[model samples]
Target chain A: MSDQEILRTTGLTMRFGGVTAVNNVNFSIDHEGELRCLLGPNGAGKSTFFKCLTGQLVPTEGTITFMGEPIAGMDTHEIVNLGIGIKTQVPNLFNGLSAYDNVRLAAKRKHLKRQAIEKTFDMLSNCGIENLKGSEVGLLSHGQRQLIELAMVLAAEPTLVLLDEPAAGMTGEERDRLAFLVKEVTKTASVIVVEHDMAFIKQIAKNVTVFHRGEIFAEDDVKKIMKNKSVQEIYLGKSADAA
Target chain B: MEKSILKDPGLYVMVSIGLLIMIFLPIMMDMFAIMQITQYVVLSVYALSLAYIWGYGGILSFGQSCFFGLGAYTFAVASINMGSTSLPFILAIIIPALFGVLLGYFMFYGRLSDVYLGVVTLVVTLIFWKLINHTAGPQYAIGDARLGGFNGIPSIPILNMPTANGQMMDPIQMFVTFMAILIMVYVGLRLLIASEFGRVSISIRENEVRSSLLGYDVRRHKVVVFSIGCGIAGMSGAMWATYQTFIDPNAFSLEMSAKALVWVMAGGVGTLAGPIIAVVILQWISLKLGQLNIINNFVLLGLILVPLVLILPKGLLPTVKQWSQDLWTIWKKNKANEGDTIIKESETVNAGRRK
Candidate 1:
């Protein structure tokens, strides 16, 4: 992992109607292969921040630079074209298509016809659902669909990946598997994961950023973040007892 | 998943049956019947355009007759001025396609939702209907072709061969020509839907936001597909002019657009054979109903469409395809179970003999 900033957001703020979803804040990813976890409560503005990064919503005030270019107003497709991948909270797979087809569709955008087919199989196997290639995505279990969505994002071979609550509806075993998968992904790309599960975060994240009331409450290593008094009171909500 | 023509037994069977009917109908029937069949063939082409956009592209255009009527008028005006069918034919296709490009750019790029798209298109069709109906005065003439308004332009020139004297095509030649065009369009559409572009278009239809996140320009794809559909509709309109030897403002009416939609809905939206089959059967029934004096044909059409929508919401062809596939799976499972039982019995018998 090299010391190069892949993405940076300066003084980002997003307002919907009269409510401020994400207050002005500066965030940056300096290492190429670092796994950063975003921990926040519901409505902590983590989703809004993720959306701003992915170009789903333009921030009302701020400048987001990706790979040294301003991307605050770029379209979602344009952002993806710049080698950034996003997996929203919702498993937005094509329900009528098979698992293979879902990944194949994403692969086709960045690869040739023959290479797309090969990459699709490779990613599906990597995600541990190669046997379910022929099954429709709608027929798959929640964990299986989540894994497929991850495979689809990986198939594009992006340099940066953003995932929002990928383990929200998974079993304990599934979360363990997801932790391994996220670790494996960071070997090739920088990753920003928005999650609320403390155990899952401890397993996957080395660097943690806690958010509260649309602001960054704390930022540090997992051990220190869990030990911090303010983070425990505002985010963990139990002080030392929760720790 | 494999897109080989041979893999779809239904398509092969339908095409074969349709070809046989096209070949033998003229020999078995009178000239008037052949002419009516020719009209149905042209209408089938129009229905195909709707299916391409609505079924495959997920664009439910309500004013498709705008393109069709534009094609008819372009053919009439060009043919009257040049006294040749060749240039008019080319213009008929090109004019509507250009118009489609213009309309689609605004609608798709403007990010109009499906419901808004339907409303805008329907309003455009009504505008065309009103605009053309009021062009009945003698001043509305374009060169030698008069805009006959509600009465329509009569004695329009038929399609002619490109030879020196430009011999006019008779009813038989026209029927064969229209059938050939219909087949070509069907085969072309089938190949397109099987291509990579077609797969991406379907993905966009399934989920536009997901497709965009996957790096697809959803707006551009929609606009291109819309333009192609409009061009095809224009071709059908040109054929309509040649077949009837007359052009009318009714071609631009709401009824014409509604009928095209009905054909697609009654047949099946996505499959090529669905709309073609639906148009032929329904038109035949409509002609039969027309012979009776008691009931209006449109009312009878409404009656048939209501039941069809209720019973086969996915349309006839897709539902039938699903049923056949389900049956095939059940049969395969049953055969596997039978084989397992037979093998188990044989093993037990061998053990008993050894004991």
Candidate 2:
């Protein structure tokens, strides 16, 4: 919970062919044990920015530093080893493996065999799918599979976690459970959730960053961000008019 | 120890069948048949190398014969110069392994896609085949062994007992030796697959990006697995040289590579026993068909493989495993239903008696 910067990106930009997906975005996160939700419309470049931070995409023009070390050209595995966990837009668990195995594999990187097994069970339990540990991840429902993927990220015990659209296909009850889980995770690790669902964001977000057209449109507390005119114009649209 | 082996029915079945063949086959078959079986055993080892890479490591190597040919050549050259079997055997394994590491470094580190990797390996095999075919002159001689080109280098020394100097192995001894080596290789690969390294490799096969994000160096793992597979292929090549007592450029031909792929596909990828069984069955069928004058052996093999491939896309062993699992689940469900019916009947009887 210390006020030390865990991640910083200076003028981060990603270009694919002639299109600039993420343009000159300067962002930093200093809240070590707090949840930060990123709100953006489709093609607003939040996913692209997340990819750059997680080393899935190297920024064409920007410098990304994690804990004051340059991580722009580092490999994804190397970035993970540096204690950053990422869950992509799609649930990326190994479908053939059991839920326990998915978490155990990630835990194996940071723990001994015996400890990893124990930690995997704990993670699955925390995610409220301990009963599904023996079930193959592929057989689980979308929400259950998403939970397993989150448990895998938690098993790694990362200092920073980046989640992309974690509750995309969840039921309302599942989304509420996910919101609680994200809030709980922030107590131990810094969490940045990129979500489009304003309801889900409202449940967990204390600090919010609204992205528009590959740039940061607004950065403020949830209450203030909801009232921001530009964020309302781009995101809420008709809903804002009714309000 | 006994309980663990008994837990795995497939292992138990494979071992019992292998032991029965080793013990009884020699008594039942003639010397010529035993010799042919030994050749098949050698080829089974070659097929295993492909299965390990293709099935387990998710690497499709279309030019695996490059390592096999290199191993045979190294064995022939070293045996002729050193006039000893021991050093030549070691050289056969080491030379191919080193070559695999070198080639694998470029392919893996350069981030070549799977198709490109196959193409590069196939081209490398062709290069070796063409390069060795032209070495037909006196200048191509190494020590007392002359590079005979298409005719091949003949009268190559067979594997000898390490303790007994100048003592060549008899056909029976070679047969037993190769079978023992094959068994050891199978066990070793099984142990490897059960290890942490094996789990990581399987994860890599399932999803490379997920494995990488979990802090696994995907490229390094690929290279290491590819090299090990190449080394195994080389060992098989060394055995082939010893069995035939000749080494040739045709060892590096595309035909050898294609045959290996067929053996793996027919047997099953991913499982060690599958490829071994496939190679033995195919070799036996090919030999039997060779006696016939009407059909070519290659065409006969094609006929057998086409149906199997079309019917069972996952190959023999995996399909069998899946079917068995399905049957077991059905049986378990039937048993549970029977138990529920009995309970209901008892409850009805109790109510009638009370009334």
Task: Give candidate 2 misplaced runs (Cα > 4 Å).
Answer: A17-19, A210-218, A223-229, A234-236, A239-243, B1-9, B141-146, B323-355
Q: Single out the weakest 10-residue window by summed lDDT for candidate 2 chain B.
A: B1-10
lDDT per residue (tens digit) for residues A135-176 in model 2: 989988888888888999999999999999999888888788
Q: Please give the lDDT score at residue B196 for candidate 1.
A: 68
Chain A vs. true chain A, TM-score per candidate? 0.95, 0.95
Q: List-wise, what DockQ does each model earn?
A: 0.66, 0.51
- Poorest lDDT segment (10 consecutive residues) of candidate 1 chain B: B1-10
> For each candidate, what is the lDDT?
0.88, 0.88
Span of ten consecutive residues with least summed lDDT in model 1 chain A? A234-243
Candidate 1 per-residue C-alpha lDDT over A1-243 given as tens digits, one digit per residue, 9 for 90 to 100: 677789999999999999999998789998789889998889999989998988888899999999889999888888989989988898889999899999988888789999999999999988888998999999888878889999999999999999989998888887887899899999999999998788788888899988887888888999998888778877777633442
Candidate 1 structure quality by residue, lDDT tens digits, B174-253: 88778878888887887788776887788888888889889888888999899999999999999999888898888988
What DockQ does predicted model 2 obtain?
A: 0.51
